[model samples]
Target chain A: MQNGYYIGVDLGGTKICTALVNEEGKVFKEVTVPTEAEKGELKIVENINNTIKEVLGDVKIEEVLAIGVGSPGPLDVKNGLIVETPNLPFKNFNIVKAIKDVYNTEVFLDNDANAATLGEFVFGAGMLTTNMVYVTASTGVGGGAILNGRIFRGSTSNAVEIGHTTVNIHGRRCGCGNRGCVEGISSGTAIAKTANEAVKSNVPTSLKNYDVVTSKEVFIEAAKGDRVAKEILDEALSYLGILFANLANSYDPDMIVLGGGVSNGGDIVFEKIAEEMNRRALKPIREHCKIEKAKLGGRAGVLGAAALAITELEHKNKKDGYIIYN
Target chain B: MQNGYYIGVDLGGTKICTALVNEEGKVFKEVTVPTEAEKGELKIVENINNTIKEVLGDVKIEEVLAIGVGSPGPLDVKNGLIVETPNLPFKNFNIVKAIKDVYNTEVFLDNDANAATLGEFVFGAGMLTTNMVYVTASTGVGGGAILNGRIFRGSTSNAVEIGHTTVNIHGRRCGCGNRGCVEGISSGTAIAKTANEAVKSNVPTSLKNYDVVTSKEVFIEAAKGDRVAKEILDEALSYLGILFANLANSYDPDMIVLGGGVSNGGDIVFEKIAEEMNRRALKPIREHCKIEKAKLGGRAGVLGAAALAITELEHKNKKDGYIIYN
Candidate 1:
């Protein structure tokens, strides 16, 4: 293994989390701070740097292998620039340069999805798999793929947009302006919206007891045997299952790691997905491809950023003809 | 380019086509022979050998760089074994060893879809691109992909099974025992099946004039302004569009090359696909990903075999640390 530490910065809308991690994925120190977006881009950058410095502690700068930043997209990963994102104030911001100017070491940047994918590939559910797909179904559906043991970024660095892929040709329109997208039909937000619609329609359900009903409440109600809640969950989860089956047929991955809020729905989620795979996916693929929940949970973001740094550093070393120990 | 000839064998149930090709993808000699598959496995093997010998002509066996065979799957590509396929009579047959025994050269075996993908990547529509997907929607909807300049064979060598991917979650049952597959809704066979169903239902249309209606007759009738034919094709082509759009969202490829019988349905097919893509695909992907008709046509199979030979040889040489001129 490489004898150096790595710093990972997980930049998000609500908070910034930084960690100092070893090559084997052990975290020695960590820090978290709110992302005060109202204070502007430079302030957010300062907060990120402060978190990095806090985590460094007694570790020398010279011992650090690389720094990695995982943020929301759309980003120009090649140039390490955040093109524009809804939550962040960055507009064509050269984030890689900002980090490198402060750290004086190699820095890598990628979308949060890709970072999480690397996290799974390196230390989570996909550790031993050569080809794995990681899907996160929360407010929205997003995914990343590791094919042949490397992150598969497509032509425009926007590959594996699994959420937007249509599962129903004449289905409801998605926020991406496409109809029948898996995200529109199966995401946590989508589930909540359906529940709210049912409530507005005065449908017979325990969901009406709450002033606000989300996907989590729906899951609870469904467990209590609420008919409408079960129907809504069944419809959403079935679409998710179709999406998984489609992915299996297309990628033939060794495994698919399901992450984010919806995945935490427990046995119902896995059972539905497995049933769909058995029904839709080709026999060989369905039999071989394992569907597992992500192991990292909330720490996925920070660890994924750390993994990004490690893998990028290794790739650079190999390309530069320098032999690496691990 | 490497100074050697390559032999390509396109193995099918009805006939075997062999071609001697150069590094530049030009065929110098070719031969075709009946497979005589009913005569059994040994006879088919003998016929394949005879075709290879005929294509060899005056070229010395020592000068041949490699032989590539493209056949129907379920194949054990790693072990060069034809496990079993609906077409042809091969069960766990070591086709690679059989070819190498006669020619004393490197032999590469891949499924037809992967071979065709390589052919497009090396010599056809995707020559200049690093990431491309090839879709053949004829009797069935099958495809292959080249990502990062190499064929992306999934864990089980069944990657890029686009036909089996679902587009209409509640659509029709497929022959593969899945419901709402693109193969079940949009493939030529599917189109023909739908048209036949309509004919049997006594739908008022020009399709009733045909004793044996196929997708071809439907296309002809649609072009002649028959309302029933137009509606059938419109519905089928719309689903295909959704399939293509979903592919764009998932892959974000530089291009998607459409081939096979359905693609050759002239302007209607392309127009419908384009319309659906515009409506469903993400803006960035729709704008960047070119949807083009396949260029190789009837020669795709033979040249694809040749391409498989060239690419596999290059890959092996690279892995073995041998340098060769391009």
Candidate 2:
């Protein structure tokens, strides 16, 4: 029963979710844990390892082929290391080897968004598509590309930092220490930050002064024709339009699958983004693409990691039931 | 000599240059003429046709395999038609068919910049590389991408519009109907425009009295330490650095080839650009890339078109003389 199991670990700052999936993309079991990241790198690694063990409690170690871990970057995918990631205290950590040591199997490591893209490609939106782009617009914007059905890591693994491409020269300052990044304008934090400032500025709107207002509330209020909310919504949509247009210009993908908490705003954001991208994007480009929300939701991270392992399994299957390459 | 004659034309707004290249990436003969848009599209077409005829003068028609025309877009590359390029005037014309009718051979058409990138791949800096980016900082900030050694055109002809990607959200307005585009910040026009404004704002530079100071003059003055010029240089370099970093994150090219007039500024621009890109680009990305100047000059245009054709020939040879689908 456990002969072909694979593991997926979603390593987040506040929570960790690990899943045991089969080659058919079905989750057999999952374990979720609170990640006390402030407790430092060793603690988080221990937490991640425990989550994997719990997910595999009923399965034999020999049954698992490999474990896939998805977390924030900057990561060295080639050497399976996390090099100075900001959220976690780990500096130049070889997380892949450590996980392999425990699981006694090979491990695959990738940036969280990239892993999610792999997840979507297999069990989610990108199924059967030859070329696609998956962009996550949550705390910060990030992207991953699938070209000819293979993960496209730019020459330096520096590919797909879509959030940092400048949308406005004189736009807001981003946490990345740069200005006008897509994340600076479209992420959940940015939206909430905008909402808070407008409420404080005494802008005429239905939104009142609240201690904190998330991007979710802004979309909810804007739907009710709250003037302040619309203004904020328009700003976000405009930035999104430009960013989408730029993405279209850069990667001629067949589809762009949007994910993250903000995408949950639905048509409130989609319509405007479509209009602007169409208006600005030109020739063989304008309507040659379709923009859609990512079909997989909260499970994208965990499932995506599973998808990675499943893909590895398929590749191995092609070579007489052995992993293609280490 | 007649066995392998091919025509390549690089059409500019002010003039048109046509070359008849042999199979060895060498120009056997060429002709150049003025393109008077004011006189209208017909005249320009006539001039273009004459240049083609002149280049062919007495050469055996059967020797030519195909003709490649590189002009400013928007155009219909598939049908060999010119839609309505920006710099060139023609409400919407078909230059490809026009040449095909006169020359009686197959024809190929692409955006001039894209044509130049293909040229670079076959005959210039991108010669041996697969994943690469070509940015021409001349009249406008034009970009072309060679992914796996083939020109990557988006769904529409508008793919690879690097200049339109904003480096400054609130900076200058762009002609593509956007604001603060990469072109508006880093193009030759942008540099000269910024220098013009700096001079007008009384930034205390030695250039205050010049009727007009170009990007070249600005670079020279900046090299000589004029404060206004230096400040403008730094600003231009910063914008370019961010632009380059974003492209790196998106494309993950092994190399970025810089061209155009400003690129000729060489080390002054390169040093600052490399520093900023290295500083801003995320990890695992900066490791496997190199930034180099385009070795081909004005010759890149015609040569690129010629290279485009020659590569096909070499590919045919590699595949045992079977023509591959382009």
Top of the candidates by DockQ: 1
lDDT of 2 by residue, A48-150 (tens): 9999889888798688987888888777777777887666887888888778767787678778888899888888878877667888888888888876566
TM-score of chain B alone in model 2 = 0.91
For every candidate, how close is chain A to the native chain A in TM-score?
0.97, 0.92
In candidate 1, list every pair of residues with a backbone clash.
Answer: none
Off by over 4 Å in 1: A320-326, B320-326
TM-scores of all models? Answer: 0.97, 0.78
Worst 10 residues of 2 chain A by lDDT: A317-326
Cand. 1: chain B TM-score: 0.96
**First chain of candidate 1, TM-score:** 0.97
lDDT of 2 at A193: 88
Candidate 1: tens digits of C-alpha lDDT, residues A1-326:
38789988999998999999999889999898999987889999999888888998988778899988999999888888899999999999988888777887888999999999999899899999999999999999999999888899898888999999888866678998877889998999999999999999957899999988999999999999999999999999998999999999999999999999999998999999998999999999989999999999998999999999999898887783111221
